[model samples]
Target chain A: MNRKRSVWFLTLFSLVAVVTVFYVSDRPSPFDGIQLFSDDTLDEVGLVETSSTNEESFVSKSNAFEEMRMEVTEKRSQLRDQLTTKVGSNEFTAEQKDEAYNQIEELVKIDSTEAMLELIIKSLGYDDALVRIEESDVFIDVVSNEQSTKKASEIIYQVKREWPEAYNVEVSFDGQ
Target chain B: MIGILVVAEGANDKRIQNSLIKTLSSVLQISPHRIVIEEMELEDK
Candidate 1:
């Protein structure tokens, strides 16, 4: 009877270990978690030449903003799916699961707010805009040839008005 | 804890950076040090 108990215990332990390994391997890296920008590789691209034609620059800026928006949307969706899985999985402790859900919720909220702000900016006559909300800070990028301080101020005002809780708001044009 | 990175299309401009920092600091009611503004050029794909 004692020998049979030890055998069963060892088998269960091994099964648990194998399952744990599989779970860990299948999970995405926490470092690769949620980001306002999905691809850090985009930062590696060199700056556009100042000598480039206005139209060409405008088109390029618009494209970049669009790509960034798409990335943000994709990442938000991915995070939501991960959150659902984490919540449903029995691997994490109750506290750990709650923390994971909260983090994902925060990311999704920020992403949604940023997307809404970007649309508002675009409707206000901006060609294209990218908005990233990290914690309490809000960053905005607008497609324009010149640095429009007036427009930037207006954006800041709009954001503050819409989301009074946002701690910081920074606005920049596409070109210097 | 808030960092804002803005990718622009042309040469870096100090004026824009300063203005952004100042505006963000004032509006957010946080010290300028708390707000980071990175201005990069947009890469064409």
Candidate 2:
């Protein structure tokens, strides 16, 4: 009985193997029609929709830009009116007036540090003193003969006390 | 008088600036419009 069972199991295994091979070899695979380089179906649909959406976006952005430009222009005109009125009513020292004019000219050039310094020095009446400029910063120091060393020191002290942004004023006393 | 510049960021900044100007005008005998105020928005980079 054991020998008969073993012969039946062998016959069943060989039959199953033969059937699987026949099934595999008989028909084309489901992936046979696919091509790696073919146009993607979903991307083509999205590309058409995206192009139309971009047109609308561009138009909306352009309108926004125009609105901003017009608003800025109106604001500028209003500011100019205010400035003119203020200038007419305000009273400034002669030095302040000169500095104001120089500042306007300097501001037009985008950078007027040198012109600003010149105006500052002249306004403070320190043009004759030695001026040192370093990296957008200015230092004022008095240079004089031995007899005037004390006077120079006093002037430096006075300047430091009076100016708002004065941090670099020095006076040499008798070369010491 | 020395120039005073105030820079602020966005609408909240404008509200704070307006409140400050109102208070200063009421207390310091200064005109509200005379203060130099500028507005700037924060940048990502």
Best by DockQ: 1
Kindly report which residue stretches of model 1 are placed more than 4 angstroms away from their true locations once superposed. Answer: A1-53, B1-45
> Where does candidate 2 stray beyond 4 Å?
A1-47, A89-92, A95-176, B1-45
Model 1 DockQ, alpha carbons vs. true complex: 0.05
Q: Residue A103 in model 1: shift from native, Å?
A: 2.9
Q: Give the TM-score, chain B only, in order for the candidates.
A: 0.64, 0.51
Considering only chain B, report the TM-score of model 2. Answer: 0.51
CAPRI level of candidate 2:
incorrect
Model 2 share of native interface contacts: 0.00
lDDT of 1 by residue, A73-140 (tens): 54565566677789999999999899988988787677677768878988988877888887778888
Return the lDDT, model 2, position A111. Answer: 24
| Tens-digit per-residue lDDT, A13-62, candidate 2 | 99999999989898866674454346774455554344675555444443
Q: lDDT for each of the candidates? A: 0.71, 0.48
lDDT, model 2: 0.48
